[model samples]
Target: MSADAQTAGSRRSSETGFAARTGGGYSGPMPDITIVYEHPAWFLPLFTGLEARGISFDAVHADGLVFDPADTRPPAPVVFNRIAMSSFLRAPEHPIFFAQALMAQWQAVGARVVNGADVLAIDANKARQLALIAGLGLAIPATRVVHRAADLVAAAATLRFPVVVKANIGGSGAGIVRYDSADELAAAVADGNAPDSIDRVLMVQEYVPVRSGAITRIETLGGKYLYAIDVDGGGGFDLCPADVCLTAPGKAAVSVVQAHPAPELIAAAERIAVAAGMDVGGVEVMIDDRDGTPRFYDVNALSNFVADPVTVIGFDPHDRLIDWLADRIVESKA
Candidate 1:
């Protein structure tokens, strides 16, 4: 193991003493709530939320996290997972696999993991996202999954024109390309110009044009609706709700007005969260221009509420999120 991994292992081992002292119960002081995550900027609001409540917590950077399978219990009782699926886009070295393993480890030991391992697994796979969407009886654009570049042509034949080829493991719109014609897709495949797949898997999906040139994203906390916002659909794909992402050139800024998704759409988003085993996250849906039906497209296990939500959505979701966390902490102790 690397030095960082060794240090993390050592730290967990030492914390066994605290576990022993508490007799595996939440009797004494509350255990620290460890935030396992990547991307410092995305977590600033979350950090602020915890600090505002004077909650005892620690940030464990997932980039260097290490967990021993032999260790039967997590050092911390409450773990909030904030590992982004898009980490690979920012850094050559990503800890997605390591983070997944660590989440499983935490769950095995009965740690109160918010947005636990199952959600992480679903969030990392777009095919799984589609399956969950379809399972929830929600509308989804027609899509086909392919494992080889040679299969792209055949897959595109099954979808409508102006299809998008997306990497199954895509995050923040990293590996997505729109092809207006089969000839265009074939040309890209022939020239090795196709978007490289992170997991050697791709999805050719029909492009669903938005009805209002905007896509609605609903944020949920502890499996309930917190707020919703609409982002300009004309904006290119890297639609991370963080203020930094919105500043990119050609990226449409988030609307300052609160967006109330249809009541049915809100219910569907909540069901999607429950189906994916996510406690906190966002669900993205757009009204199809052709049918006027809301089609659920993306399920974000790690939700970064749009920047300055109070101004846009009439309330600060992070404060509400922290309230949920505080309740979980108290419940864990009880």
Candidate 2:
């Protein structure tokens, strides 16, 4: 790792798992856990894992902005994390920044935060994450991060028409649009860049034609590969039921095959997670039909698997992920 990366890693590591000491070193303690989640249903696996392990954790809604460390509610020696804050869920408006501040303050007071602020900030920026992924020698589609429609149009021309225009902060197919003709691409970019719209810049890329079947979702827990899910999707951009998607590769120009990606792709995910400080995170990749290279498109630091684990990976990821987190907690203490 470069000196800058190493320095950033060290700082992030300390922030995520260490407790400050009066004598200037660090101390360890039992991990009092606080879960930040909005949907109880989606977090069933986490809750199940915690319960199965006999660990008691306080659950906090992600929408809250005020947190008092002094309250008898949650004690120290805790891991404060809300895995649900990923783009899978829409970020609450107005208080989002303040909510993050409160969480950081709680951590400052004593709690160890898994997937801490540094990690979250880095993972949230799609362009930065993609650049890092590409830097790690992963194959990524030709991409252009642009603030204006003209730049996007130019990039499209360079990338050769029918590019994918996506919001820089988008996820789970949100804010994703495909434009076949130059006019269509230009119109989409104009809408995205309009003042009344989000006004957020976009990341445009040459849409890789993926084989139909499934897209691979690889999760890394503490720099270790956990599991991959083949996300079978509709032949087109829309989402279809997993069963339907897995039946056969659709005839769409770009089909979705959500399966265990190539070994190279898994390695790419590992590198990304380690660099992004995601002890536990997921990376999404699509097999490019043009050259048959698995090109990375998304990195999610906070992720939960709701798909059928037994059919997808031949085992339950909940058990594996929780076990890894449990062991990492002990290892961190050590």
Candidate 3:
């Protein structure tokens, strides 16, 4: 069969199956919401949940999306941003910057964008997020930032040995490397070992020892805390809840347990989300084993909520997420 024919058949089957999830009674106008996303598989459950609730949405791939600034109408009344930070790991021609412009245009014409461009700008740049978090009087890891690979060695000198050199635009721990000593970092830099991020910026940061051998990832919805997970870092940098990143080559499988962090941590996570303009996202923090201080590190706008929500978090977060999106859709139309 022709590929197009096969795709059409598969789409029909998918629609039929999605209808079953919500009991097959939705016959409303399509495009109540537009999901701006890149990854193909991560949002399948989200789509199913939206279908279950009869909330019609259009999914647009960020990689090849095109729009004219003069266009006043959005594909839907509400636009949900699912464009990821780790997109660069999948392709060099990733749409990190393209998404920024696209969402800004969507907002300009008054689309009720969930996790809009301003939040995405913070999400895209690690250096900017650290500064933003610090501006709130929160504790961040001791680190140095540099734009040129040549400056990496000098930056590492300020921090103790066993530091990670991270890319400013890294996603899912893409451009992170550890150097145990000054000599090792210098040799890497001399031999051109400095990591190449989408943008040329790099961060040389002191690796904080993880307390209890795990880091905390707290998820938020509508700028409020929804759930938290303790992902065992296990001496690796990538702590994405997705199996794809956790089981990547050279990375061992990590344990994920539902966590009940202190009220202060939950409050802090909510505060960061509100300040960062994150409508639906997650914040990651590592408790410094040496000082017992919780150091906020990563602000992720793209939250593909834990692998199996029911088994992991006792309830499916996607249900609540779709409910919120449905409310936003109603508000947007009004």
Candidate 4:
């Protein structure tokens, strides 16, 4: 480990978001964990972390991934899910649903799936996330849900102007577009310019001017608060904070920094995680610039921690995550 990552080992307790230590490697016939994922680049850091700890893991790329019902034995004792909802953006034939089935198959036979199928169902749908958050008596953006782009115009009538039409199954900011006027939205629907989700569900939401031009993303693990990062996109909607995204050609830069959330904010995030069945994920709440109301809009099952951990956030969250994974390996064997 470099000095930056090594610095993380010294800081214990709350700053690291986990209490366990990286109990080290696994030497078993089957690997300790199997990560089911679709994206090619996102899990590089995680793979590196797992390997650094001398842990055993298997990476199953979900694209064109298949399995049979006859198979009873699991490849690993613990399965970690890494499938992304925005997978459809990279390829038309995405594995978002296939991943759910695969993990369900694993879980049925007693494999401990981190961020399993139940959690993926919530991660894959925005409408479901909003309802789940609202059911907890939490605030969310004023929005309308519909199954077709044509209905978006009608839905717009119920919401304020300058609203955004978001695909219910979206990620990395795909399938989201903002319209300033009702006519603009109507024209978009008329010209077939409005966005459609993989699941064909759409949400016309109040374009809450992001307070302070940024939105805060709170990460949780094991239904506990891990850490939060405020992501600022400088007026861009594709505000994904993963470092690899920053290097994409022609993409505007985003600012990512650690945020020490209040007790209420942390509690609310934790509640949403538990409700969503998210073993490891993030909950996003943007303070409505209009009235300073914190509108909880998104709950993500995949948390690619912010870039440059040591300098930006004082420690590498990945270290603690590895610690948790190591513990899981120990648990599965016991």
Candidate 5:
């Protein structure tokens, strides 16, 4: 066997039928957690958390990921899928469809994958997200889905004034533009100034004025409530939770404050997470100025916890995340 394969086999053998060592002196098998992801910066906290716990994990780069259909059992017993829908912004040439196929393959083989294929599907398509929102009886923005640019103007007419055209498959708030009037949207389309959707699908959604100038993001882990944070929305579209991305030139630095969502909101968020088949994720809700009712807008299966959790949210969420993952690993073994 090759040297690397031999080492892996040795490590796996050591870990079999035994509890892995901990407390910085771990000599057991390497971490069984395999993180499949695209962005590097967003995952630094998770990597740090794993290292701090003396756990070693293998990272699969989504840009060049591959899978063999015939190989039913993957290398890791537990895989944490961290692939972002916004990955197209970083690597436009990457095959996102292939990533989806691979996730489905992983599920077929019964791999213990967090944020599995179902969540990835919902995360990639906004139309599907809207359907899920409506199906769950949650309040969603008045929205219309369109395929061709010619339909953009017509679609805008159906929604209220001051509507936003968003990409059907959007991430980091890409391909979203606000129009004050239908005439403005038509002019943009005529001048070819309208943003092109990444997947050629667009959603014209009514712009509900924020009542508090902020939105609440409730995060869940292992299908249970973990914590919630409020993000100032004056920063515009891109509201990446990672601090590094929050420093864009034109984008205001978003302030994240811990929040306690109402019982109904908490229940609603949990229901959405379950409906989306998400194991770890965040749900965004904004109260409409017109009605004072909370509107569920975004559901994310991949969560990058706000930076400096202790200072921002009063505790480090990654610590709890690590514990959850460890328990999951142990359960998989059983």
Candidate 6:
């Protein structure tokens, strides 16, 4: 998509999914809520819960590229921010800057962001996330977030064959690649990582061997652990449902879930969440079959439980998530 086309799509999507109202417009003493999201599929349950509570809310169409709420004033209450702007699903730089800008716009008019932009910034950066987890004394694999090819080679030498390289951003496993050999890693890096084809630095880590063929994704809201979603990344590079993925497992792939994680893993995840400053987020940890210990991996700010039924752990994660978010939103107000 051309830059103009991309920007236009983002704006249309942001606007279509949300409804916005200004001062003297919304009625009732309830919080005047504005949900900023681009995908309608994600908003349904969230809006449903808000409406169930009889909360007065609006939708504001804003994309990461051209998200400027110049005409609207920030209404009282909070902004449920769920905005993304990267055209390339696999490789999204901190396009969340747009979400930050929107929150800043709301703050100018006297309102609070649900999780706040600062929380998003800190959690979104993979390198930063690792540091936070490490600071919390959690066990993490010997990982490397490198920009240049030479550095990647160095990191590779430190690991066994088959290193995992994931795009620094995006959800549903957009630009996640696994190279079983050093040669494979070199070729993937040369091919230009994602749609942007920008020689962006890729995160290379020692692929934790897993016998179960699934990764454990645990969601936490306002520092409270909710539920765990087992994401079967189909064991390939393209796991993001938004894209065409052949790498993920077909229906034949055996996937299952348990209500609880190993006690140690859960405790570790809780610590990671707190240290990372994630008000509402998800932490992905891979259980190493070799050591039978969980390794902290990805930390997502706008963590998704929405696209559940079809992916990972088969359950209506969105409903549980909506309930959790609504509770937190109300709790914060209280």
Q: Candidate 3 lDDT (Cα, whole model)?
A: 0.80
Off by over 4 Å in 4: 1-28
Between the candidate structures 4 and 6, which one is better when assessed by TM-score? Answer: 4
Clash number for each model: 0, 12, 0, 0, 0, 10
Question: CA shift at 218, candidate 6, in angstroms?
Answer: 1.0
Q: Between 2 and 5, whose TM-score is larger?
A: 5
Model 3 TM: 0.90
Q: After superposition, how far is residue 292 of candidate 5 from its true place, in Å?
A: 0.5
lDDT of 4 by residue, 1-334 (tens): 0111112222232312322112212223667887776666777778778877888766655543556555576768898988888788888888888778878888888889999989888899899999999999999999999998888888889888899999999987888899999999999899998998888889999899987898999999888988898999998887778776777777788988889888899999999999898988889989888898888999989888777878888888888888998888899999
Misplaced by over 4 Å in model 6 are: 1-31, 64-73, 84-87, 90-95, 187-199, 237-258, 306-334
- Per-residue lDDT tens digits of candidate 5, residues 1-334? 0122222222221212222211111123545777766665677777767867877676555543445666566546688888888878777785456667777777677668888777888888888888998899999999988888788898877688898888887787789999999999999889988877677888889998987788899999877899998888574887776666676567666767888999899999999988898889999999999999899999988788887788888888888989999888888778
Query: Model 4 TM-score?
Result: 0.90
Q: Model 5: residues >4 Å from true position, as ranges?
A: 1-31, 248-250
lDDT computed for candidate 4: 0.81
Q: What residue pairs are clashing in model 5?
A: none
lDDT of candidate model 6 versus the reference: 0.59
User: What does candidate 6 score on TM?
Assistant: 0.74
The lDDT values for all models are 0.77, 0.59, 0.80, 0.81, 0.77, 0.59
**Top candidate when judged by lDDT against the true structure:** 4
Which digits, one per residue and each the tens of the lDDT, describe model 6 over residues 64-135? 334335535454567776754233342344436556665676666656677667666664466777778887
- Model 2, range 218-298, lDDT digits (tens) per residue? 878878788776665544553322332234254233333336566777777888888887767788787877777788877
Off by over 4 Å in 3: 1-30, 243-251
- Candidate 3 clash pair list: none
As a whole number from 0 to 100, the lDDT of residue 188 in candidate 2 is: 58
| Candidate 5 TM-score versus the reference | 0.88
Q: Model 2 residue 159 lDDT?
A: 85
- Report the C-alpha lDDT of model 1 over 161-238, residue by residue, as the tens digit: 999999888787789999999999999999999987667888899998888778888988777898888877454676
